[model samples]
Target: MTNEFVLEAITREFPESVLLHSEPYGFLTLEVKKQDIKKIIHYLQDSSLEINFLTDICGIHYPEFQEKELGVIYHLHNMMTNFRIRLKVFMPRENAEVDSLTELYAGANWMERETFDFYGIKFKGHPDLRVILNDPEMGYHPMLKEYKLEDGTRTDKDDKMFGR
Candidate 1:
């Protein structure tokens, strides 16, 4: 199906949930309410649209945005038609949490865990949520923009060489 048709169907089904929508590089991207993400994804999967494959789930940190400092992005694909769509939900950095998609897509288990490990975005209702790539004892989420981009204390690396 065409992007407009899918967008219309979703907007009709979730009139209040969709905040913004755009077609970038011909891909449908939607910014939706964080609370309704699970419901909207469920509808997309179960409805006639059949956008059933969960391609990926990732987290983003925008520390300067205040209320919208942290975000989660989800990509879905309709394998039969080779159509893909993206959905995003943003929340305050203080409470970066969202509904876990593991219940809907089995592959989401690891993706959510990785997002949590790197960006500190908790996935509520995830059965085995824990640090996947980082050490369990690590206290900070390194992917966050709050962290330093380079270690100033490293004596071996000269800042001048890097034009810093």
Candidate 2:
């Protein structure tokens, strides 16, 4: 439907959770409070909008950005009408725990894992939370702005280090 209709429904149904609404790039984006994510998801699922496809959920970290310290970006699609919406939940670096959407969407399984793997945003109640790409011993996330490469050098030690 229209962005105004969606915004009105969301604001009326969930006054506390819906933080902001924007129509950028001709798509409706709802900035939701992290704590009320489950409620919002349930509403979306039950609404006529039929946003059944959870296209992607990824994490973003902005060490210098002022608006938010960390963010979890969620993109959902309504396959019936081919409409889409993006929801972003902002969190501080110190307290970054948004309710897991896995219960609502099974496809969120690997998406959440990948977000955790790169941005270190923990997904509570995740069935199997582990490193998807990086070595288990790698403590720091390589995607973060603070991540540093070792002296910008490509030495033989690098090739031999991981047994490549």
Candidate 3:
């Protein structure tokens, strides 16, 4: 099956759930509503399209977007066909929560935890949701845009080590 076949299948299944569709780097990327993410992904996993592999799941932070400040990105692959597609569901930072995919894919457990540990995006109904990498005392999501990327106050020189 070709990429267009995959896109057509999704658009046909959930006409309204899809917010945007784009092909960048020849990869089909879809922006879908947060509420429909579970349904959409469940469909992709079971439908005749056979997009059954949960290749990766991650989170993104766009602090300036307000309503779309936080997002969860899912990469799916059809192992037999070697076709891959990406889906994203975004929501406001205040309500950075979505349905858990553990019910559908066991691998989602660690990926969700890592996303939560870094971006603070909560996966509702997850059996265990806690920090996997950072210390619980860290208190904030380090990947969020609210934090600075670099410290300008550094006086100690390490330029050579960084190839600067």
TM-scores of all predicted structures: 0.92, 0.86, 0.91
> Which structure is stronger by TM-score: 2 or 3?
3
- Candidate 1 stretches greater than 4 Å from native: 153-164
* Model 1 error, position 162 (Å): 11
Clashing pairs in 2: none
Give the per-residue lDDT of model 3 (tens digit) for 1-164: 88789889988999999999999999999999999999999999899988999999999987778999999999999999898999999999889999999999999999999999999999999999999999999999888766444565776643454433
Top-TM-score structure, candidate number: 1
Please provide, for model 2 over 62-95, each residue's C-alpha lDDT reduced to its tens digit, 9 standing for 90 to 100: 7776457889999988888787888999888888
Candidates ranked by lDDT: 1, 3, 2
TM-score rank order: 1, 3, 2
lDDT of each: 0.93, 0.82, 0.91
TM-score (C-alpha, index-matched) for candidate 2: 0.86
**Best-fitting candidate, scored by lDDT:** 1
Give the 10-residue window scoring lowest on summed lDDT in candidate 2. Answer: 155-164
Q: Candidate 1 on 1-164: residue-level lDDT in tens?
A: 99999999999999999999999999999999999999999999999999999999999878778999999999999999999999999999888999999989999999999999999999999999999899888899998876545687987765456443
Please report how far candidate 1 places residue 50 from its true position, in Å.
Answer: 0.2
lDDT of 2: 0.82
Model 3's alpha-carbon lDDT is: 0.91
